[model samples]
Target: MSLRNNPKKSMKLPLTTRTNQVVRRKLQQSSGPFPRQSTNKPQRRPTRIRTTNPMQLLSNPAPNDRAEEQRKLRMAQNRLSSRNKRLKRRQLSRVAKIQHTSR
Candidate 1:
């Protein structure tokens, strides 16, 4: 009888064993995704830990010198000048609004 009509006759020979052997050989030759892990090897540690506070450097900063004092004075003068300019602009806008309303 034909092997198609009797699959048990095909398995009675070395055909099914040959296919299993070929599949096992292919699996051993190729490194699939699930490679066997070794318990003897230690796990890898991260290079750097990310749990540090970013503002720790600002907590203990450099000592203020004469250059720092000069910078502070310049910043204060700039703030005063900007405030005066803003007040002048507001006063001019208010005068223009009043003139327009009167007209």
Candidate 2:
């Protein structure tokens, strides 16, 4: 089970300086840390959701300027409509999923 006394085996290398140089050369040749392409480009993190309050807009009376009031009203309406559309779509999808699973 022991090869310590074996004539074929040796613990120390005869050419340590040459071996160290070869190892150093191989290490230098290898790409350091990360690939060149990855180093050139940076990664983008996910962005947070934008916040809007329809209730707050509705609660506060519009400004006296007719044009500005109209624009604000239109924007609020668009936001509410889009939110409703998304909710309705989600509900419809859930219903469809239930029906599919029942079948």
Query: How accurate locally, in lDDT, is each candidate?
Result: 0.76, 0.74
* lDDT measured at residue 46 in model 1 versus the true structure, 0 to 100: 72
Model 1 CA deviation exceeding 4 Å by range? 1-64
TM-score, each model?
0.38, 0.37
Q: Which pairs clash (backbone N, Cα, C closer than 3 Å) in model 2?
A: none
lDDT of 2 by residue, 1-103 (tens): 2456764544344688658877888879987654666688877888644335766555553455456888888999999999999999999999999999999
By summed lDDT, which 10 consecutive residues of candidate 1 come out lowest? 32-41
Instruction: Write candidate 1's Cα lDDT for 26-99 as tens digits.
Output: 87987753344544567798764333464753453345644686799899999999999999999999999999
Runs with alpha carbons beyond 4 Å of true place in candidate 2: 1-64
The prediction achieving the highest TM-score against the true structure is 1
